[model samples]
Target: MENIEHLYEEYAQTVYKYLFSLSQNADLSEELTQETFYQAMKTIHHFRGECKISVWLCQIAKHLWYNEINKKNKTRSISIDDLEIPVHTGKNVEAAVLQNEEKLALFRMLHRLDEKTKEVMYLRLSGDLSFSEIGDILGQSETWARVTFYRGKQKMMKGRSEWNSD
Candidate 1:
């Protein structure tokens, strides 16, 4: 078994990013990240090593966020600012703004996808999870996760082309 502290060090950011993709709320993601670690610590012994530790941690975070949303009966929308899309252009304000706008547009398109596709994109792009890990988290096969991600990517590309033509 890995040390709890090491697991926190390695997986906290990944878990937080996953929650952020779902909640789009930094404060809530932070809370869920902490809660994820807490739960992991409590249930460490139950971990069966079937999946990567990062995958397991993200699964916990996903469950926590969903359960909270279910209890509150509220839906959270993804905002451009919520994505934390990096736009560092070495002090070029115009470049930064343009990059940010592009990211905003991309996320807006992403929001139009079905819930499962959106989740797959979030996990693949934001959480940096592999298809296998995503499948483990979503309770599907890796092929399904890969196909969903590819389909979502194609949709995003089409959306981008339409936006550009407009």
Candidate 2:
């Protein structure tokens, strides 16, 4: 019990960050994070202590996230009210503008990807899961996961280039 509490306290923020990265919605991420812990508590009795607790928790979170995403075909909407366009305080106006442009470009590129590729990218980048772990999560081979990630990155780059051309 004490050990479980300590583990949760230490890893909660990391779990939340991973969840937020995957969902991109504060409310949904928070809800899913809670769900992850709930499931973890119920299943902890089965843990073999063979892997890092963080990794196990992340796996749980990833599964829950994918389940939620599949259950809802519609993309999660980002409300304008949640947008945090950083204001430049001093000499970084040009840098800030470039950063904002990059962010918009990335967002546009992401929107162009199909669901599978997007999931690969999100799990890889946001979840920080290795190719093998991603494979397990997505039910694909590690090589397939790698291929999907590379292809998705290429697609995003191509989309970004086309957007720039336009």
lDDT of 2 by residue, 62-152 (tens): 8998899887767667789979887677669988888878887787787789998897888787767678766655657889999999999
Candidate 1 lDDT tens digits, 1-166: 4698898887787677778767878899999999999999999989999877877888888789879999776666777887975546677878888887988988899999999999899888876777886786776899999999999999999988998899
Model 1 Cα shift for residue 139 (angstroms)? 0.7
State the local distance difference test value for candidate 2.
0.81
Q: Against the hidden reference, what TM-scores do the models get?
A: 0.60, 0.58
Number of colliding residue pairs in each model: 0, 0
Residue 21 alpha-carbon offset, candidate 2, angstroms: 3.0
Whole-structure CA lDDT of model 1: 0.85
User: What is the total number of backbone clashes in candidate 2?
Assistant: 0
